[model samples]
Target: MSVDNFCETISDQINTGILVVSLDFTIVKWNRFLQVHANVTPEKVLGKCIFDVFPELPKKWFERKLSSVIQLGTQSFCSWEQRHHLFELPHTRPITTDSHFMAQNCTFLPITSDNVITHICILIEDATDVCHYQTMLNKTLESLAMANRIDGLTQIFNRKHWEECLAKEFSRARRYNHGLALIMFDLDHFKLLNDTYGHLGGDKVLVETSKTIQSLLRLCDQFGRYGGEEFAIVLPETDLVGAADVAERIRAAIEGTDINFQDQIIRTSVSVGVSIINSQDKRYEDLIQNADNALYKAKSSGRNRVCLSTELP
Candidate 1:
């Protein structure tokens, strides 16, 4: 075979798309890969202007590479991920882990004739798998972050998440002067219950109590297990009266429910203390402390009761 025949055969066999264009950005040659992948037939696309074939190709994109190759006689790469929309395709090439990639990685090399640049050859290779894998990895990481924010035992917002939310709600309340109430409640004699019931019965009470309180809360309220037997509620746009009412409702719900364990009906009750934000209060710490004081007062006075700190003058 002659050298010309071998060169032609090599060009036809290569899987990568090849396109040769002149200084004026007119197509001079289109290879077999280009014909198949780009849905362009050589008979129609050859010797045609780029803008005429694909008018959507921005002027800046063509001007940057075409002018540079003609003037500087330099070779440069054009990744399809960056210049994908230049063509008039309705959908971008879909990338998957198991499928053959359809993206393009092109190199622009100056073609010289008689010591003057006449044309440029653009070589393209597919790189779709890399993009798909990166997208999947990012989604997986986001799912993990969301899972870590939940408490394992109580299935509620963990302490870290609750503190962050508290800080954000505090700032919002301060900014808008909106009513923000914090209620701190704990299971009275929880330690004794855990000790008497061998931790299993105590676990049952905690879980059941959470469900009961959840049913009574409004959509805008946030409830989280602050610690072993203590839980906190954040009520947005609720005044002291509203907070006190909600607390009483939760107390009543828990007091009315009975936990059955091994054919024994065990009564469970919660002591709740509620406090609404006062313009006079200086910090979040004070709000929490006031609620905590009320909770202690409830425990001291009697279990199964709701007390509001804002009632104090």
Candidate 2:
């Protein structure tokens, strides 16, 4: 076949909108892709001003963009990311897409005559599928980031995120010289409980305990799973006395509630250690260490009780 015929064949078969416009902005050529999708034949659009044909287009911005391409004799391009579409043409997949019309990537190429620019060939490509995949990927990334912040089993803050919160609370309390407290608690005889009822029973007890503690906490409290059968809470604006009261309340609540697992009744208790920020406390870890020390005292003396850091020494 001849070169001109082959080029025409390629342009006709390719599935993208193509149009050529003269210096006066008159539509000179329209490809089959545009003919089918835009539902306007070449006979009607040819020799007609583009602005007259499509009145909804942003005339000023388009004129400026086209002027630059003509003067510089270089190609120009625009994506759907900037503005949605160059034409108000109806897209083919209306049933599936949420979009009202087609999203487009428009390219303006200078068509030269005898080494001088004369007309511009505009190519319009549908970016609907690309936009769809990008949106899905963004949602997936958001879900992953959220999962990182929460524990998979209990749905509370995970160790890393909870520690981050603790550090921030510590800074705020120290800066403002306000009150703050930390509570570290362990389920008493957890190993024995697990052995008696299997890991599944222990899991249920942990899940239920987390829910119960959450229900009792104020909005300022931050809870997290420290490790297996162990948990921690950061109570903002809480003093030593108030911290002790909070610890005791959590202890009694857990002791009172009966957890049912595998159609069998099970019971568990927590040994809690409470500590408040003091003038001598150098860092956030110091507060956690003090609470841990009190927890050891609670466990050593007896399980199912609360211990205060101030009473330790």
Candidate whose lDDT is highest: 2
lDDT of 1 by residue, 91-124 (tens): 2354334334455567888888899888889886
Cα RMSD, model 1:
5.9
lDDT of 2 by residue, 31-143 (tens): 99999888888999999999998899899998999999999989999998787788987877787777887888999999999998899999999987776677678889999
Query: What TM value does model 2 have?
Result: 0.70
Give per-residue lDDT, candidate 1, residue 200.
87
Clash count of each predicted structure: 0, 0
| Clashing residue pairs, backbone N/CA/C < 3 A, model 1 | none
- Per-residue error (Å), model 1, residue 185: 0.8
Lowest-sum lDDT 10-residue window in model 2: 128-137
For TM-score, the strongest prediction is: 2
Given candidate 1, what's the lDDT at residue 67?
84
- Show where candidate 1 strays beyond 4 Å: 1-127, 258-266
Q: Positional deviation of 33 in candidate 2, in angstroms?
A: 2.7
